[model samples]
Target: MNVLIVHAHHEPRSFNAAMKSLAADLLRGQGHEVVVSDLYAQGFNPVATANDFATRADAEYLVYALEQRHSHGQGTLAADIQVELDRIKWADLIIFNFPIYWFGMPAIMKGWIDRVFVSGYCYGGKRIYDRGGLKGKKAMLCISLGGQRHMFGPGAVHGELATLLQPIQRGMLAYVGLEVLPPFVAYHVPYISEAERRDYLEQYRQHLLGLHQLPALEFPSLDDFDDALRPRNAL
Candidate 1:
């Protein structure tokens, strides 16, 4: 399988980095082609702007989505965005390796998605959710958290992990048609022992090796919705 790891962390020696490194080695050893996008190291531009397009569809206005569709159709996307898009196109599985910041992804990673998952390419019109542009590909998040597991559930301080991750897991990944896998979260990494950290790495290795057979998170399909996008039964 072709695998792409989009790593977003400033510190090279961080636990998130360790997981990213482990994944690359383990996946390569299993004979899978692996690619790593070290966002911070590469200094990837997280900001979306008019400069993304070489030629403007409408010089008078800067509608990002419209510009993206036009540029992509014209084969004129920015060099950086094109590179990331090409990687996404080539990969069967994409693993996002990052540290959860303020209950969400790092700004750079979010920026990567904003630019790369463009309209008319990743999703647009009716081509979202089950019928999204990346429908057949798989995506999973490998995140490290400072909070303990118990602090993130019902009646807890952080509410539910699933709820907190819905924006990325559902709004981004699934919206683009990628099969969303259950995230591998390392809770309280800063407070954990070295031995526990090593154990997490081994667990991650096992997860990657079984990537093909891992169950994806269930989501509502297009068929389940009515013309107005309401659930059929609700309608």
Candidate 2:
């Protein structure tokens, strides 16, 4: 399978980096074509602006989504965004490797999604969720957390892990039609021992190796909603 790992972390020696590296090596050893986007190392621009488009769709106002659709359709997208889009088009599986920051993804990773998953390319119109443009592709998040596992569970300080990731998994990945796999989260990496970190890496390797057999997270399909996007049974 063709795999793309979008790694977002500043420190090369960090546990997140280790997981990303381990994934690349292990996947390549298994004969899968792998590509890694080291966001911080590349100094990737996280902010989106009018600068993203060479030709303005609307010079008067900067409507980000409209501009994206226009530029994409005109083939005038910024070189950086075009390159990322090309990678997305080529991959069968895309993994987001990052450290969870403030209960969300790092800014760079979020910006990557904002720019690359534009209207004309990733999703628009009725093409969302299970019917989205990128349907048939797969996406998973491999994240590291400073908090312990217990802290993120029900009635704990952080609430449910699945709920915490719902915005990205359901709202973004699922919205774009990517089959969402259960995330591989390494909890309390900073407090863990070296052996535990190694064990986590090994576990990540097993996850990647078994990607094809893993069942996707359950999400509501378009068919489940009425014309107003409310659940059919609700009306």
Candidate 3:
């Protein structure tokens, strides 16, 4: 399986980067082709400039708060961009490894998602489940946090990690038709001792080696039991 590892952490020695390296090595060891997109190192154009679109040349997609996938079939990435898309096309699984800042992903990672996941590529919002583009692909996240595990639970300091990541799992990945897997998260990374860190590193290595063997992600629904069953007037 070909795997794409997009990492957003800036510091080379950061735990996030280390985890990225660990995942890459483990995947490669298993005889899978791996490509690491170190955004900072690559100096990727994070902004969605007008040039990205084949139709518009002077307007920015984000200005209109456009969230739909934009195709790069004719612009800067054009054919070159298709290469990365081809990688996604070729791969069985795609992994995003990064550190969450301000309760969200890094700008670069978000930008990559914005740029690469284009219309006719990632999703069209026509079919509800497993019917759009990227139907057979799989996606998972590997994230590190400075907060303690206890802090992420109910009535805790950090709230729930699942809650924080629900959109990515349900809305973003699954919304686009990719199977979303439960992520591998490492907590208290900033405070953990070196010995503990090394142990976690080893554990992470094992996870990467066995990631493909993990079970498939089941899609969820807006028919949440907690919310009222009646359809709302507003979309």
Error of 3 at 16 (Å): 1.3
Candidate number with greatest lDDT = 1
Model 2 clash count equals 0
What lDDT does the true structure give each of the candidates?
Answer: 0.94, 0.92, 0.72
List clash counts for every candidate, in order: 0, 0, 0
| Tens digits of per-residue lDDT for model 3, 1-235 | 7788878888999888889988888778878899887878877766656555444433433431133243343343544345556777787788889887776788888877766776656665354346647777888999887787898878888788778887677767787778877688888888899998898898887776676688876774434322443344445
How are the candidates ranked when ordered by TM-score, highest leading?
2, 1, 3
Residue by residue across 54-173, what tens digits does model 1's lDDT show?
Answer: 988998999999999999999999999999999999999999999999889899999999999989999988899999999899999999999999999999999999999999999999
Model 1, stretches more than 4 Å misplaced? none
Question: After superposition on all CA atoms, how large is the RMSD of candidate 2?
Answer: 1.1
Clashing pairs in 1: none
Residue 172's C-alpha lDDT in candidate 1? 94
